[model samples]
Target chain A: DQQVKQNSPSLSVQEGRISILNCDYTNSMFDYFLWYKKYPAEGPTFLISISSIKDKNEDGRFTVFLNKSAKHLSLHIVPSQPGDSAVYFCAAYPNYGGVTNKLIFGTGTLLAVQP
Target chain B: AAGVIQSPRHLIKEKRETATLKCYPIPRHDTVYWYQQGPGQDPQFLISFYEKMQSDKGSIPDRFSAQQFSDYHSELNMSSLELGDSALYFCASSSLGGGRSDTQYFGPGTRLTVL
Candidate 1:
């Protein structure tokens, strides 16, 4: 079953505007959430993350807000630049089965920033 | 800064052949994870290792096997390769014990194509 979902497959935004990407998870046991951005032929790169203990985490121009009750989280990039265009994947880490953490990923959202 | 390293960024093999993918974690990183991503799909977890031991398992096929060495490097071995095995394989590393190393660092993926 798909535990994590990113319903919007694509998003388009103007440069210097706000870019928001959303993700939802069905597994409440997930304790850590992260966002990764990927370009064609490249591995996904880390963007931002928030632990379930907190509602929000900010890294400079990027902010991630998590709503635990809603089982949803979103990444907001302000003053979005054209270079920010890429496919973004939302991943959740579930510390289950007494093993190391395993990440569950969503289908990803493609962001196109028009300059 | 050091980043995760992967070898043979691209590989082509015939059906029934075997292929080996290698990953070298960043210095002092102790955890390794493997993921496979197909066209238009999210990365799926295969397995993870902690301190040279198997820590978690995911949707890995029976024909596939993996191990982490004492040096903190990991290798994925695929046997009886099939066309369906074509995908981008990524190796991610995390320190897991301390610091921002909790965040996983992904290497440039290896693209494996089986004909």
Candidate 2:
């Protein structure tokens, strides 16, 4: 069940350019979305998140825009640095009354920022 | 700053062997999640626990079982392992009631290789 999908497997950008990564989900139960950055031999690091109620959330050079009607979300990194190169995974959590809200992940997009 | 910790960063086992992976969440986190990532693939959710109780389950194989302890740490037990089981296993944790509680912080991951 590929509820969450990242159509792009790889994205390449020059340093100081903007990198855009996108994700889509089919399940409307997902009320929380997040973007994670992962390096080889390590775990995923939380980069940014956007709640369903908000259309955009920004932190420094990172911005996440959510479009609930389209069931899509995108991550924008401005002035991409070489250090920003990594595999980015988009994850979503369904709204649940229970204490545990599990996440569904996309296939991931490998962003390469060329120096 | 504390982060999730997973043990046996690397493990090798035979097809029929059994293995147990451990996870220690960040201080005071109340929920834990388990994910498996095959080479060249995104992390797949397996199971989760909240307040030491099983809260959700995913595509985990029948030979696998997991539980949260009274201390809030979690363990995933895999029996009758197969070569396909070889992957990187990650553990993540989050608190239930903070502004950032919905965000998950991942561990370094355990690389399991079935021989």
Candidate 3:
């Protein structure tokens, strides 16, 4: 069963605009959520993350909003640059306490910023 | 500024051969996770380790095995490799004691092609 899903496969936006990517998950056991950006032939790079305790987290130009009741999360990149074009994956894991373990990932969304 | 490091960025192997993929976690990070991504597919969790011990398991095949060493480096060993094993393997690390404990930093993936 696919616990995490990113319904949108691709998105296009003009440079300097705001790009929003969404993700949904079925597993309520997950307490930590993160977004990763991946380029062709490269591994995913860490973006922003939000714990279930909070509704939003921001880092630089990237912001992630989580809605626990909806089981949905989104990554927003403002002033999107052409270099921001890449595939974005949403991942999560249950952190009961001490150490965290495996991560379940969504099907990823490809965002293209047109200059 | 250091990130996770993966060895043998590209590997070509024949069916029935064996392949070993290595991952070195970032300094002071205590967790390592392995994931596989096939063509047109989202990344699937494989396995993970914490402080040199097996922490969790995922969809890893019986032909595959992995371990973490004292130095915090991990290896995924695939025996009797099959063509279906061809994919991009990624290693990610996270620190449980840091402020960004929930975020995982990924390395440049290793591309394995089996003929």
Candidate 4:
């Protein structure tokens, strides 16, 4: 069972536009959510995260909005740049079973920021 | 101050052979985790360790096992690998026992090819 899901396999957006990536989770036990970006042949880099207690978290040009009631979260990048083109993954930290903050990840969304 | 470091960036193994991947977590970090990513897929949770103890193992086959020592190093062993085992294996680490507030840093990943 895939606890986390990213339905959109790929997204294309023009530079200077806002790019939004969405994720949904079936497990209500998850309390911490994070986004990671991956480039070819590299490990995923931490992007942004939000706790269930908060609705939104922003860092400079990137923002993460969490809707706890909907079990959904999204990452928004304003004025997208070509450097932003990469595979983005949404992951969740499930506290169930005392798992030591292990993450459950979605299939990932490939974002292509066209210049 | 090197983040997570994984050895043997790429490996090719024949079916039924044993494969071992090594990881050196960040200095002073006490938690280590393993994940697997298939082609065009998001990373999948495998297992996690804290202070040399197995904390969690998520949906991994019995053939897969892990060991952590000295709080800064870990290894994942796959015995009698199958074709399906071919994928990019990543190692991640976090400080402070990887609690809700700690963020994980991932290694560049070890690409395994099972023939």
Worst 10 residues of 4 chain A by lDDT: A94-103
- What DockQ does candidate 4 score? 0.72
lDDT for position A20 in model 3:
96
TM-score order, best first, reads 1, 4, 2, 3
Model 1, B5-113: lDDT tens per residue? Answer: 9998999999999999999998999999999999889999998888898887889999999999999999999999999999999999998731221688899999999
How many pairs of residues collide in each model?
0, 0, 0, 0
lDDT of 2 by residue, A1-115 (tens): 7999999999999999999999999999888899999999999999999989899999999999999999999999998999999999999887765544567899999999999
- Which of the predicted structures, 1 or 4, would earn the higher DockQ when compared with the native? 4
By TM-score, the best candidate is 1
Model 2 pairs in collision: none
lDDT of 3 by residue, B28-113 (tens): 99889899999989888898888888887889999999999999999999999999999999998888732224677899999999
Q: List the residue pairs that clash in candidate 4.
A: none
lDDT of 1 by residue, A1-115 (tens): 8999999999999999999999999998888899999999888899998999999999998999999999999999998999999999999878664444567899999999999
DockQ of each: 0.53, 0.57, 0.60, 0.72
> Which stretches of model 2 miss by more than 4 angstroms?
A96-100, B97-101
Angstrom error at residue B37, model 2: 1.0
Give the per-residue lDDT of model 3 (tens digit) for A1-115: 8888999999999999999999999988888898989999999998888889999999999999999999999999999999999999998886556555677889999999999
Error of 2 at A24 (Å): 1.5
Indicate the residue-level lDDT of A22 in model 3.
97
Q: Which 10-residue window in model 3 chain A sums to the lowest lDDT? A: A94-103
Evaluate all candidate structures by whole-model CA lDDT and list the values in order: 0.91, 0.91, 0.90, 0.91
